[model samples]
Target: MQNTAFTTAWRKGVIARYLTVAGATVDLTGCGDHTYYRCTGCGHGTHGVSVIERVARERAQGHAETCRALPRPTH
Candidate 1:
């Protein structure tokens, strides 16, 4: 038997998310007027995007489409 921790964007204040090719998650989170994406697989993410929602979404989708890193263990 094993246990793993599962979380959600809404619960964590994330605005959106995408699933990577390896089943990992790319979370889109925002603070105040700034938005960004962070990958749970290989720690790939965005920075200094100002308040551009489209750019954040675009980068998140692009990374999700190509990222092959498997989801890291939740232990």
Candidate 2:
């Protein structure tokens, strides 16, 4: 059995975009080089983030909830 939820980069991208639109902070880090994004009035790595689609489609929705509950930027 394989987990197909959020397993696709394209899906991740879409969710990322939604987060951006929702005014959530986004950060993509690299080994030596790093990139940082911020929301208008919020800081990075504060609150958790989620995908409505994932929650609705996942078999173990509770797992999805936990993933979204992870520490993340609040912006």
Candidate 3:
């Protein structure tokens, strides 16, 4: 399947730290106290108080890998 629009949104960072791999959507969002990752396919996510953004990014990537949903490499 082609997800050109999804990839474009990810590349542009239109929704902050959000990514869609395969049919799963990973969204990172937070308020003043905490940040969280919400995955649609997995039906669960992680969050922390004042956690670094990279941690969340890594978690999302890990989930993608486990789900075998990583995006295909572009030429």
lDDT of the candidates, in the order given? 0.75, 0.28, 0.55
**Cα RMSD to the true fold for all candidates:** 3.9, 13.4, 7.1
Instruction: Compute the lDDT of residue 4 as modeled in candidate 1.
Output: 19
Order candidates by lDDT, high to low.
1, 3, 2
Arrange candidates, best TM-score first.
Answer: 1, 3, 2
Give the Cα error of residue 36 in candidate 2, in Å.
8.1
- Candidate 1 regions exceeding 4 Å error are 1-11, 31-33, 47-51
Best by the TM-score measure: 1
Which lDDT value does model 3 have at 34?
Answer: 56
lDDT of 2 at 51: 30
For model 2, which pairs clash?
A: 24-75, 25-75, 45-73, 46-73
lDDT of 2 by residue, 1-75 (tens): 332223324323222322232323233221112222222223433133333433323312222223332223223
In candidate 3, clashing pairs total 0
Candidate 3 residue spans exceeding 4 A from truth = 1-21, 31-33, 47-50, 68-75
State which candidate, 2 or 3, has the greater lDDT. 3
TM-score of each prediction: 0.75, 0.18, 0.51
